[model samples]
Target: MKTFARLVDDSANFSSDITYKKGGSILSMIETVLGKSVFQSALQSYIRTYQFSNADHEMLFEKFTEAAAGTVKDWCERPMNVTRFLDPWFLQQASALKK
Candidate 1:
């Protein structure tokens, strides 16, 4: 799988397969990991905080981590904040799946 960041460099990578299919899968994983309540709250907070402003991944991650309240580490089964947990998914060109 290509990284989300990589898709921006080439318009060719912009397709329903990547943007919708894979993106939906990734979102599902994140929601599952963060739990519905925390995930929804984080998204709500992010939108509310940046509705009329610019927001980057780091900003969104900060909201997620803040809403997680340290439970991200437990949910991820490792010691990591939302940024660390999501970096590979967004920044690296590989499957973020871990067994």
Candidate 2:
């Protein structure tokens, strides 16, 4: 989120950020980042440098909303509203396993 905010800091495009990836294989993807802990620590340092300003989740969310709406519909996809967990994003193909 910090990197994203910095990338668009020049523009008031935070309101339109509609990206919210699901929990499908995100855990696996996160595991691929070997030095994630180190990266997170560095990020925390940056956060601390600005925490005194009271800029936090709520403020970030507000900016994100502005960015998303400013961009075209294809810029990013919105989160899905589901009545059940039967969606494929949570499912894996059994045939993909060699066992």
Candidate 3:
């Protein structure tokens, strides 16, 4: 399985199953982890902060971490950096399934 952010080569087919299905599943999982309210708020902030501009995963994760400050440890039951917690999910394939 490829990661959600896998690099595409010139010969890549770009299947819809990967683009839509897996993408949707990953997004749903992220929302579930953050809770709907925090997820939505961070999403809105990300959009507003980067509308009509380019933004990367780190930027989005920063907003999530900011929104989740203080409460993240409670939710995760340990102190963790949001970006660190999510990096493996975006950087490697099949890792999310293990959790």
| Local lDDT at 93 for model 1 | 52
Candidates 1 and 2, the one with greater lDDT:
1
Q: Which ten residues in a row have the lowest lDDT in candidate 1?
A: 3-12
| Winning model by TM-score | 1
The order by descending TM-score is 1, 3, 2
Those runs of model 2 whose alpha carbons end farther than 4 Å from true positions after fitting are 1-18, 22-34, 54-99
| Residues 1-99, model 3: lDDT tens digits | 866876767445656456567667767877887789988998999999999999998998899888777665644486536787777777775455455
The ten-residue window of minimal lDDT in model 3 covers: 10-19
- Indicate the residue-level lDDT of 22 in model 1: 64
Q: Model 3 residue 1 lDDT?
A: 81
TM-score of each: 0.71, 0.24, 0.70
Clashing pairs in 1: none
Q: What's the residue-level lDDT of 70 in candidate 3?
A: 67
For model 2, where is the 10-residue window of minimal lDDT? 79-88
Cα lDDT for residue 6, model 2?
47
Compared with the true structure, model 3 gives a TM-score of 0.70
Error of 1 at 68 (Å): 0.3
> lDDT winner among the candidates?
1
